[model samples]
Target: MTSARRGGRPRSFRSARRVRHRLAADLALLLVAVAFAVPLGWLALASFNEHAGLRTSLPHPFTLGNFQAVLTPDTTYTPMFNSLLLCGSATALTVAAATLAAYPLSRYRSRFNRPFLLTILFATCLPITAIMVPVYGLFVQVNLIDTLWGTALFLATAQLPFAIWLMRNFMDGVPTVLEEAAWTDGASSMQALWRVVLPLMGPGVGVVTVFTFIAMWGNFFVPFMLLLSPDQLPASVSIYTFFGSYGTVVYGQLAAFSVLYSAPVVVLYVAIARRLGGGFALGGAVKG
Candidate 1:
């Protein structure tokens, strides 16, 4: 018994060392998470406190006036609605166009595909800022400035390179044989793509839609340049209105509006997470 107890000491010490290392790693991660979360937490707390500034504090006596002030017709309502309309349209257009574009890329085996894909990769890496001056000139020539639909269309087009790249990868994981069976049933290529391929790609579709919506929603520059009307602004630009011309600012209201502005993206993320309950087994997607 004495000999066995002594032998167990080394194993116990090793286990203790592992636990200590794991605890340290966990503490480091916790600190990192808190660092990221602190500003967001502060915003939420300040949103509820009428007297709150940019600095975080526990709300001494919480009030909903900041939110109420922002939500009134003169400030947040029009911009928030415009953002929803513009972002939703852009997301729908981008997803539909990307689906069509990805189908051919995923289905065909062509020599041109690699070069075309490389072109798209290069386009994806191109900074939007670099092309904005040219885009603005093009918009002026076409008389598309101040038009919501035009702006949404441009947003969709701007995001196409990335969206098509992501969608094609998702489409490639789906088995070719499924579409072949649909083709055998006398379905046209587009019909097969629509009826067969898209049904199985619900999660992928959700991901693309969420991504496009968030991108458009958060984009300040595109709309800022193209949209001339104050009524057509999105929350991203409208948030700047809280900063007064004389350098005075409405910190509490800004925080409240920020919370509201970020809600849609958060909701979309949660919905997508729930919709994608588990990763699809691409093993079953293709058989060796």
Candidate 2:
């Protein structure tokens, strides 16, 4: 009876301890989540407030004037449009270029392959800021500066190494037997790639698309340096223009514009989140 009572007490103690640990962990996670969410919540609330109201410490009445100000013709829609255009074109180019480059890397194994792959990986590791001056000078000499095409070309090239690496990793997971069978059935190399390999690469393709879009969309420094004209600037540069070197910052407008700017990205992630997980997993699997 004493042994049974002893066992019961110990078991109860452990159970209580476990419950306390779980409760502590849950509380920690909840606190962390709240910490992360507060800024976003504040930003959202600030976006709807008036410029005068934004300076206050407490919650104030909301207005759409900030968003209205952002939407006005004199503000920055043209730059936003330019950014969208450049980013879209750059993403398409990256996808095409990466796909082509990846196939060769995945399918062929020559003595030069390792060195070439290493070179790409090395390029990916280097900061673009390191080469910014030289790239800008080359663009100026070629008279490509301030052009959307030029910006797109630069963005595409910068993203190429990472994109190729990602695509090659994805392609490595694909069975070569499928391509061989296609070849046996009189399918050309292009046909096999298009009909067989590509369909299986949907996840990797989606991952690449997301990466390219986000990178190009958010890039500020390159666009700021290359694009002198306001009309040619991207959304990121336009956001900077909202701030002045003097006093009295337009916090309301800035917040409103930021919220609006983030909408597309939020929508994109919401739309692709389901696919992103699988795609990322497959891409990583290929690498493994």
Please give the TM-score that candidate 2 achieves against the real structure.
0.86
Kindly state the number of residue pairs that clash in model 1: 0
- Writing each residue's lDDT as its tens digit, candidate 1 over 1-288 gives 999887877887889999999999999999999999998899989999878987899876899998899998768889899999998899898999999989999999899899998988777777787787888899899999889998999888888888888788889888989889999999999999989999998888777778778777888888988888878888888777888574878888889899989998888878777554586321211110
C-alpha positional error of residue 252 in candidate 2 after TM-score superposition, expressed in Å: 1.3
Q: What does the lDDT read for residue 261 in candidate 1?
A: 90
TM accuracy, model 1 = 0.89
Candidate 1 error regions (>4 Å): 1-9, 245-247, 274-288
lDDT of each: 0.84, 0.81
Candidate 2 stretches greater than 4 Å from native: 1-10, 52-59, 245-247, 275-288
User: Candidate 2 overall Cα lDDT vs. reference?
Assistant: 0.81
Residues 1-288 of candidate 2 have per-residue lDDT tens digits of 999877777777889999999999999999999999877777887887774344433335668888888986556577678878999999999999999888878998789889999998877777887788998999999999999899899999988888998899889989999899999999988888899999998887887888778777878888888888876777888888776665667888888888877787777777767765553543222110
The CA lDDT at 25 in model 2 is 100
**Model 1 CA lDDT for position 79:** 88
